[model samples]
Each structure stands twice: as C-alpha cells, then as structure tokens.
Target: MFEQFFPNGMLHYLAGGLLIGAGVSFIFLMTGLVSGTSTFFSSAWSYFSTLPFFRQKSFLESRQWRLAFALGLALGGFAFLLTLGNGQAASTGVQWWRLLAGGALAGFGARMAGGCTSGHGICGLSSLQLPSLAAVITFLTTAIITAHAVQLAGVLP
Candidate 1:
C-alpha cells in the first residue's frame, strides 16, 4: 500500500537532504553565518527598520527588490524541492489563508523566542550550543502537541 505513495525515491531524498545540510554547514563554516529562513525575515525587518533613509531606498520604497528576492528564493527553493523527488508532498491543496495564518504565528513566535528554528536548529545545534538543543526540544514538543491537538479537533484537513 505504501509502495505506491513512497515509490523508490529514497536515494533522491537522501541526496537532497545531504545537499541542504552540507550547504548550510558550509555557509556556517565559511562565513560564520546561519543560513536559515529566519535570516531572510530578519534581513527584511532590519532593512526596513534600521536604515535612516529606509523609505528613500528603492527597494524599501517600491518593494521591487523584495519581490525579486522572494521570487528568486521561491525559484531556488522549488528547484531544491524538485531535486528531492518529494515534490508530490509539497502540494496538499491547502488554502493560502492557512499558510498566511501559520506564517504570521511562526513569525511572531520566532521573534518572541529570540530566534527561529533554523537559527537554533541548524546553526546553533551544529555549533553544539546548549540553548539550541533546548530550543529544538521545545520546538518538537510544541509541534507534536499542536499537531495532535489540531488533528483531534478536526479543525484542519
């Protein structure tokens, strides 16, 4: 039964996962930077808030730069997803509202938590930071509880 759904994409999944892990590790290793989704959001926030002439900046004023950056990131992420052969799992026919709501919640949580899953999960854990380990444990616990609660409530499909 699971054969039809899973097929034989184990190698692709392994390779894609390895590529992402290696890429993020290499980025941290080389630049001492964390390559995670939070970084992009943080950069966006900083660009809009910290700059004295943020409003005067072309990217901030028109948002064209932000749009272009998002497009590029989407395309690049799509390429990465496609290479994984798990693209079928990407589309769940979910509505945009659900995603937006989730994104907003996550954004707020990341801010309140002082960092995001990527910041703490990938970079922090890789660096063997105790806080990151705690963060990861808390994140997983929250996810499990929320998922089970949502499923039990039948609020989501």
Candidate 2:
C-alpha cells in the first residue's frame, strides 16, 4: 500500500519530517521562539530596508538568527544535492517568469494570512492553535482545487 502511493519509498520523507520536527522543537525549547521561514524573510528585510515596518524592534532583534536560519536552509539544500542528489541541480522546466509570479503570489498570500504553511501547519497546529487550524484548512482546500484545475488544464509539471 505504501509503495502504491510512494513508489520511491517513504524513508526520505519520514527522515525529513523527523529532522524538521526536531529542529523546530530544539529552537522552541532553547529560545521560546517559533521557527518559521515567513517571519525570517520579514526579519531579514530589517537589515536592508529603512522602512518602519522592517525597522520594528522585533525584526531588528531577531534578524541575526533568522539570517543564519535562512543561510542554513540554503546550504542544507546544496548539501543534499551534493551528498544525495545527482550532484547537479535539476530544472523544473517552468519558465522563469512563471516561477517569479508564483513566488510573488505565494508571498502575498503568506503575508495576508499572517503566516505561511510551515508556520501554521507545523508549529501552530502542533501547539493546538485554532487560527492555524482554520488557516491550514483554507490552504489545503485552495491547494487541492488549484491542483485539480491545473491537471484538468493538462499542465502537470
């Protein structure tokens, strides 16, 4: 049954999930801070932008560790490519403009929602937050509809 759904096997997915859970748990235990990439992005802007929103004390104070977290995320992917992948980056075959547009849309949605999937789905849900439950429901619903619509349009990539 597992093979029927994940022909490549589930070890990697399981390992990744365990690692993520451990990392977030460690961060929370150590600092009492929720580890979420969306806030990291906003915190990072504090370094480069003079705008009041970016200059908030919360962003200013957290930007350093958030920068390190962001770097680790990038380096972790590179390390995975080097050690586990084909040692070459694979392209998704999507146009650059499409990728950019999709990223923009996702960022806008994340901001509007006050958090991203990782924030709400992982940390917030784990903490039994009601708002996160609602947000995750909406996220999953929209994702399912969009995915089916895309497949119906024969754009599967």
The TM-score, computed over Cα atoms with residue i paired to residue i, of candidate 1 is 0.66
Best TM-score among the predictions, by candidate number: 2
Candidates in order have lDDT scores of 0.67, 0.85
Q: How many clashes in each candidate?
A: 0, 0
How many steric clashes does model 1 contain? 0
**Deviation from native of the Cα of residue 107 in model 1, angstroms:** 0.6
- Number of the top lDDT candidate: 2
Q: Name model 2 segments beyond 4 Å from true.
A: none
Alpha-carbon runs more than 4 Å astray in model 1 = 1-10, 50-73, 80-90
